[model samples]
Target: MRYCSIPCRVVGALLFGSVAANAFAQVGQQSVPLSADDNAEVEHVWRFAQETESRSSLPRAVDANWIENARLGTLKLSGCAAALVSADGLAVTSATCLRSLENWIRPDDSVFVAGTLLEERKLPGLTARQLVEIREFARIEEASEDLETGFEAELIAADDSSTFWEYVWRTYGDVRLVVIPPADVTDFGNEEGVYPRYAIDFALFRVYDGQALPLETESYFAWNDRSPYVRERLFATAFDANTPFTVITLSDTFSYNGTISPPHTTLYGMLDQYYSHGATGAWELTEDWLSGIKENDLATALNFSVVGECAQTGAGLINVDMEILGIAFDNANTEEGTRCVVMSTSGILALLRTVLKAQGVADELAEQALP
Candidate 1:
């Protein structure tokens, strides 16, 4: 995604008083101390956003406790989704998450079981090992319409979730995903016909062992695809209070047009992951409903920035009450800027459905769907 920093003052007017309470009020006065469900989902989304921002802005050390408690899974062999696809022993996540591994592995390498937890943790440091690249069924070019239409990728694993986490911890365990979407699809397209199509904002993939890590819990934002585009106020909190909470007023949708073809391919592949910010966390309005309000401006605004010095990879972008918003995909330090990107809940849901369908597990989940 394109990186440009605007003077905070340019957004000061729109951001003024755009806190969670204010956004909630604008939506409607429900109740303070939101219901249990609301609290979990909302808080999850809020913290995820803050954690992502914090990683971008500073070199905050990863807490061991936080690492131990995060959910662990892998992406489907090609697409950017992460979840425990089966109890019988398969884990799913995104291919991009494992791209580094794909680059190094040799074809003749053999897969071996690492005896679950303790042994698996030591797998990465072993010297007598060879990296193996598993062949996937799809390619990026095949999935896109042109140089711009986004492609879908997936990752498949034979190991269970526990093994997944163990592998992550041993190799690269600190990461997060955040989801953001353009207020309107038109803002993402260009005359070349390259545009941002609607998809999940972000998803998380963490490593684990036999025990399932508690997934980030919070009250989730309800999907409102039909809601008209408006300069709505939104709020997000940092995982650490030392960091300032951000309140954004999405004034107007900005357009981004680019090619998705090798070096550019990685950049193109990441556009969805890159621009997946805004409303990734919990949203609220004040009780009076008059605070944190902004109108769509003609200037068309985009909120994008990197937290200096922080490695926020894999930190959860949560809403208030701690529901999972998405995971942090980039570390600011690596690029001399915040490298975080997010996918939305809807994007995650789609991946979940797709992976489950591929694994033939969706039928079971469908039977237990909540009313």
Candidate 2:
């Protein structure tokens, strides 16, 4: 992953114009909220706000309600993305993307882990922007002027139409590193884009407001400690220069069990070769867990179809219930196309528990659930 000199949100607004315009024609001015019938099956916290514009531009395969929820918790980084995983500024993203903080990483320091909060190092001049409000208008000038300080606004229009969407963002400047696994775990096998992969591939960080305190926001995703299973429907949220904001559908979740065959074309094609190809494999991994806690293979990776487009690195993979399953760290290629690869939050949870046990921090992960 590469760090960007310019804020990616601004880039997203510039790139979203064409797509947003095209979406305006496909759906009504307003979007339908999540159906009550579906909510009866499973209570969902991801509800569409009245201020959110029609999300026709997002993939139709995913529920727009969940997509809106995902967007609200998303933070645009220099060249990657992160998901707000707790109410108190804790976020999860790909460990690889944190290379942007190389300057702060001392030569003698262990790049592989950050055992405690006292060890969390701040990256000065770095900032993250969260999409706090979305307002649509008949004309750019019609947008409200209630902009607050420290927040930035961007206007996006489709073609020459009077319709426009004003994106309001709250920027956080004091970001610090939290818990991170060793590179050996995050980049396990160093296989980069290969399938049948195993890697932790995730990292944690905290965002602080101007008061130099942990940011407290209600729009955050709770961590899902359980593993994703086969045939499960999931969504990946990320941003890139190509598509500033994206919510890609990931279905047919499976674990790679058989040997890699030749002529692997697309992720779908690779899976089509065998029956019952989905499974989950886990093992015990221990390095230095604070006071040395032992645990089974907490690191888990799930493979899924990259519907429509490949997800950008550091994208958060969220389930239907709006809980975050993991982070998309890499995209593997088959003969046909590319597929998104995700690492479950189990590994991060394991590390957090270890830190809490040894360091005795009660606020670890903002009191979020863990196993």
lDDT of 1 by residue, 19-84 (tens): 122111122222232211211111122123334543332111212222222222222222123333
> What tens digits encode model 2's per-residue C-alpha lDDT throughout 1-371?
12122222211000010111111022222222332122211111122333234333332323454446567777888888888877778888888887654466654554534455566778777788887676777876797677777898876554555466677888888899876555544554456775545565677788988888888876677676665654344556655555444344443433343444221122222123222333211222333531232333323332334433444778886654456777877787655456667766654565455532423222455355432
Over 4 Å off, model 1? 1-97, 101-206, 209-252, 255-313, 328-341, 355-371
* Model 2 misplacement above 4 A: 1-68, 112-118, 143-146, 242-294, 297-310, 351-367
Which pairs of residues have clashing backbones in candidate 2?
A: 264-335, 265-334, 265-335, 265-336, 266-336, 283-297
* Candidate maximizing TM-score: 2
Candidate 1 weakest ten by summed lDDT: 2-11
The true-versus-predicted C-alpha distance at residue 125 of model 1, in Å, is 5.7
Model 1 lDDT on a 0 to 1 scale: 0.25
Error of 1 at 12 (Å): 10
